[model samples]
Target: MGKLTATFLKEIILLARDRSGILVLFLMPAVLVVVVSLVQENVLKTAGETGIRVLFIDHDRQSTGQVIEELLSGSGAVEIVKDVDGHEIDEETARTLLAKGDFQFCIIIPKGVTDGVKKRVEQQITEALNAGNEAQNEPVPLPSLAVYFDPLVQGAFRASVVNVLHRVVLSMEMEMKARALSNMIPVRMNLILQEIMGPNLINVPVGIFPRMDSKWGSERLLDVKIEPASRGGVEELPTSVQQNVPAWALFGMFFIVVPLGGSLIREKQDGTMLRLLTLPVPHVTLLSGKVIAYVLVCTVQFSIILLVGRFVLPIWGMPVLEMGSSPAAIVLVVVSAALAAAGYGVMLGTIFRTYEQASMFGPVSVVIAAAVGGVMVPVYVMPEFMQKISNYSPLAWGLNALIDIFVRQGGIRSVLPEILYLLSFFAGAMLIAWGVFIRRGRTGG
Candidate 1:
């Protein structure tokens, strides 16, 4: 215990003296979390929170255009920009503005659209009512609405805008068709009454049919209920801070390998490792002390990120981070993650002989693991093969465990598998490191 404590203090003194290492461990993660979370929040808001400005050129200038404008404005997902300065936007100007990305998209309502749609719908409905007659009317083509989008717009956002426009147009068509059918039904029934009861008796009560619901096109009988899925049975709202904070913090934790591995290489190159081996203290104790010191640094680093997410980010207009109900679960996962990271560092230090080798490989390996682990992008959104492969990364285990707690409102029981995986990984890494150390002692490498 005494030797372990002394070794621990010695490592702390060494780390504090290395200002650059301290900065990398503490400052880098803080800056990364803040910048990334805010950027993501803003990007998400562009679709809904802040309305996207869309160019609207209504050549129809009739009921069709007016109804579309009213529906889009009511949706509040986008702002309709009809003109530039005081002049109305023509198709050419709208296209030019879209090319320049002045707006994400443009909507052009063709001239006489309302009349053309009404005529086509009434004609189609009339032919349907006159089915089985030898005289069939010619089909009338419906005029189309034109929409142009910027090349830079994302496919998902573009699809969303196009879908809204489709809904609006479909609603208008359905309403117009229903009204036309209502008006034509009485005329068609009067003709049937003349055929059945003769022209003089057409006004008889038998000619009248039941009144149809005029609001069938617009009135909704069934409504869709939206709710979030969560295991804890509480509705959970996903936020960028919840995702990026724990993700980048775990990233910073694994990054401990660079400094920790470099420390080991520095000790060996300067003969400090050789001198330490000659001491009465057990080699295990010395190694344990370094692990403990780095684990503490990892803990502090994670806490700083959490604080930034919970307090600092909210001031910058991001959602305040919500720590899960189980603080103990958070601590347990953080420690397990710290141990996993430290073990990997110890293994790298044991295998590599120079600071350059350790420094370069440590960061690159962590970054690769992080990428596979759903830190940069959610694993569920990745290709199926990548998602299956991500399960192998130790960083994936830590990140999944943290997300379960922070976002899913999970407890230790929920993250037990990940905790076990991380611990087993730590044991395996430490074993490999120990074997390499013993082999080096025997061969004097």
Candidate 2:
């Protein structure tokens, strides 16, 4: 057998002999997956139960203002705050609060609304009479009521407010009309004012029609989109079987190369590497074997998670298989993850002086990778700046590719660029690890 092949076989044998290392690399990921999934589910459920908070600002101190407040408060959906600790809220305070997202909506009632509505109705009546004359038809004007509301409210809530305001205005108009008709005498004299030294009442009618238009000073609601999802659209993996399965799976795959890289560091630290220089086995063969062993461990760990996710959890990721190109995409995700994890392990092993340090750093590196790559939080829900930063991490590419396969139902071609990027990341990380290891050997550092 080739020296490299023999070295790889020896590494695999060594790994099989270490039962504790085998469990850490294999069983831990399954546990992590379960824990993360449960936490996500609970958070999502809680968020859904509590509706958004909104505030009401009543500017009009009149009866109409009271009616508006009553209408809004009557709905169990809203909470009305008339004063904040004995201090009245102003427009500026409302704006500041809204900008901070303290409240989803705010209602503002302009002063003189009742007076404005009355004047507007009179003006509409006069306009109707003129229009009637031009059309040679009897004038029947409608009330032109004005209802003003702030434009910074949410769309759904604003629409509800408008509907309630229309009802109140209609009631006011009906009451005014009833009082005016009741005061009209049986024989109303249209020319009473003419004979009494005035001709202003010559065309006066017993009852005048009020000119009313549904909208006079209404404004559109604020346009804001809020995502009310837990993990902001991140998929839920099953947590019943494993507490930190996903985290472990990701880290386990990554740590597979640690031992391979650790071997060189160990030899240097023990002074055995120099003593072994007299042997026939080449240095390149020893490194090759270690890398191969890491690949094998990563492959096994990945396969176990896939089987558990499929059969045990019954959790089917996006049906990429139906796309006829999912197989290629799946292959790409697995290969990329394996390569990147191996490279990461190698680098950690090379940098650390002892096996304990390499082991500790392995999990730490996985956490950092998950954080930057969006394993903890979804990239889409993250702030725009964070999404930009995530692009630099290999975990981001791997997770994205996996999400495409599971959530977006993207085919192989759709994720080709991501796969290529991951591959490049793996190659780059591996190159760095190789360089560090070789340099350490040469410098005896």
Candidate 3:
């Protein structure tokens, strides 16, 4: 234990003395998080607050079209704006606007919409009243509302507009029915009364349809009930920070490979390994001390990066990092991730033959792994094929576990899978390093 402690302290001192490496460890990820967060600020807006810009072309100069326009304008989910430079635009121009991303969607209310709706409603009611007494009327085709959506808009936004349009259609149909009934009911009642009373009784008041009116109130034609589910207690960070902070931090953490491999190569070249082997301590003790020291180095590295995200970045006009509900679980995640990174560095050190080889291979491997792991782009935004392959990257698992804690407000159980995967990577890497050492021992090289 004393020897291990001495070796650990020596590793710490050597790592601290390297000023340039320490700078890169802390500087790169901070710059990335700040730059990327500033650039993608709009994409990280909260749900229901996204103001989708829409172009409304009301061709039907009638009440129904005007009502639909009013409905969309009032829906808070979207913003209805005049075309570029406040110029009036037609359907073709609106389509062009949608293509240019000036508008998220285009709504075209076709001509004769009011006439078409009334026509359909009258035909349906007449057919219903006279069913079996005469041949049914053929269904009238109503004019369709043309909706052109930009392919860039999310499907959820498009679906929301579609739902609103459905409500408009239902409201239009009901308005036409109410008008038809208001005019037809009095005439039909008078006819029936004259037939029953020899056309001589006092005429019933024209407004006596109140009895039926009370039974069929047309105020709310569609009753939409929403049963909302309970949400989590924690407030999450913007999507960008939630994704980028840990992602780039993991990228930086794995960069420990450079110094770790370089350290091994430098010691081997100085005949330090031979000298250590001649000491009383077992080979595992030396390896354990090296891994332990670097793991602590990695832990400090991660904590510094996290502190930048939590405290420093916010001062630079960026979102502050939310450490989540379970700081203990966060500690576990950090320690495990650091262990995996350290083990990977050890494996790289054993595999490479020289300082140049270890230096070149270490950073290059980290870049490839970080790229595949979604440090550059979010896994959610990646193509399906890329997302499928992302699981192979250990950095991806490390970032995922961090996200579980940070964004999902998850406890240890939620991140257990990711923790286990990182531990597996650490175990596998250490075994390979051990195997390489055993091979070197047998060959006496």
lDDT of each: 0.88, 0.60, 0.77
Model 3 lDDT per residue over 1-445, tens place: 9989878887888878988877877777677767776565555442254666678887788987777777666666666665668688798898887898877778787889888877877777676665667787677885788889889877766787778778766765666687776666776677778889985878888777653442242377578875423128444434666677787778878888888878876777777776777778776777788899888877877777788778876786667777678988888888888889999998888777788998888899889888888788778888899899899899999888888778777789988998899999999998998888667633333
Order candidates by TM-score, high to low. Answer: 1, 3, 2
Please give the ranking of all candidate structures by lDDT, highest first, separated by commas.
1, 3, 2
User: What TM-scores do the predictions have?
Assistant: 0.93, 0.55, 0.74
Q: Tens-digit lDDT track for model 1 on 1-445?
A: 9999999999999999989979977999999999999898987788677777889998889999999998888778878998899998998998888898887899989998988888898888888898958486777786999999999988989999998888877777777777878777877887787899876773745336665655687666789999988776878777888889999999999999988888888787888887888788876787899999999999999999999998899998899999889999999999999999999999999899989999899999999999999999889989999999999998899889888887788999999999999999999998898888777743334
Candidate 2 local lDDT, 238-332, one digit each (tens): 23223233344665576565566567667778876666555577655665567667877887887787666545554432111111226677776
User: For model 3, what is the alpha-carbon lDDT of residue 401?
Assistant: 83
Best by TM-score: 1
Better of 1 and 2 by TM-score: 1
Clashing pairs for model 1 are none
As a whole number from 0 to 100, the lDDT of residue 388 in candidate 3 is 91
User: Per-residue error at 326 for model 3, in Å?
Assistant: 3.1
Global local distance difference test of model 1? 0.88
